[model samples]
Target: MILRDVSFAVAPGESLAIVGSSGSGKSTLLGLLAGLDVPTRGSVSLNGIDIFALDEDGRARLRGELAGFVFQSFQLLPALNALENVMLPLELAGAKDARQRAEHSLAQVGLSARSLHRPQHLSGGEQQRVALARAFVTRPRILFADEPTGNLDHATGAQVIELMLELNRAQGTTLILVTHDVALAGRCGRQLRLEAGSVVQ
Candidate 1:
């Protein structure tokens, strides 16, 4: 296997950090682990469910049930308010009180005053906070964060990272973070190092 034979496991409620430079397949491994993509030669199981065995719709459903993600770019809909953006996944799951839950989530990320603001109206850090709120509103079993601090300045990024860690501890939610930042990765309980599309250590 050119990508290398890698085998490891994350305990329930554990946080695993993946660190590598760009093009090292850190993001690719995360995508597979989160069921956003399937591996060509290996199997990935999330919460004991084999993701590759499921069809696309099935994978989507499973992901909805178990996974959440925060990407580097802050993937929020430009037209949606902070509240609406956070409510999306919850509403998709048919939560009757999505609005209230979304409001609480936004507040947790310190964006209460900006709840009615759209992405374009917010600063980069604020928009990233919105993305974090949206990813976490569902209270997913696992969260995959790809370079979550990539867009923020040091102070803002530190606050955001603290929020994520706090949520993980309080909820016992598993976290898998892919990043090139060594300091950020060090905060995680266990670390997985990747190089050239392979797990190196």
Candidate 2:
């Protein structure tokens, strides 16, 4: 197992950071927490629901209804413009106002003028901001971010972090941030340290 006997809880609207060195399973833990991967043992509960108790499709349905994710790579589709990428989740959830909501989300990230730009056309920070807009557009109850600033320079990364925290507060959503930057980890309300697949602190 990549992680063993690692356990913790996050309160609603609370911010938590998981920090560790390379290959220490921080990303693995985040994936399990988000239900993107099932653990070999134990269980993960989201909003009081034991995700492990559900089948794959059921877990996916629940994830779609409750979670938002931001990754180090930004993960925006190259073919989709900022507006379209932000609208993808809302559209999948059958929201009739996906466009309007996506626009509002983009505006929140100060990316309104770049809404028509594709991923390749935007800068790194702008691309990440678009990814943020997409993640928040769903108004998810929880947000999972893994090394969200890994690909940005110092200043841009700080800006992204500030924006994420601002959105988390505004929406009253729980945040689980995974990163190696100690300063970044300190920005969270609480911190978890992992080492060799186990919780060390």
TM-score per prediction, in order, is 0.96, 0.98
Clashes per prediction? 0, 0
Best by lDDT: 2
Cα lDDT over the full model 1: 0.88
Q: What is the TM-score of candidate 2? A: 0.98
- Error in Å for residue 132 of model 1: 1.2
RMSD of 2: 0.7
How big is the positional error of residue 115 in model 1, measured in Å on the Cα after superposition? 0.2
Candidate 1 C-alpha lDDT tens digits along 1-201: 335677789998999899977778887788888777767788987788888999999999998998889998999998889899999999889999999999999988899999999899999889988988898899989999999998888888887888888888887889999977666888899999888867786
Candidate 1: residue pairs that collide = none
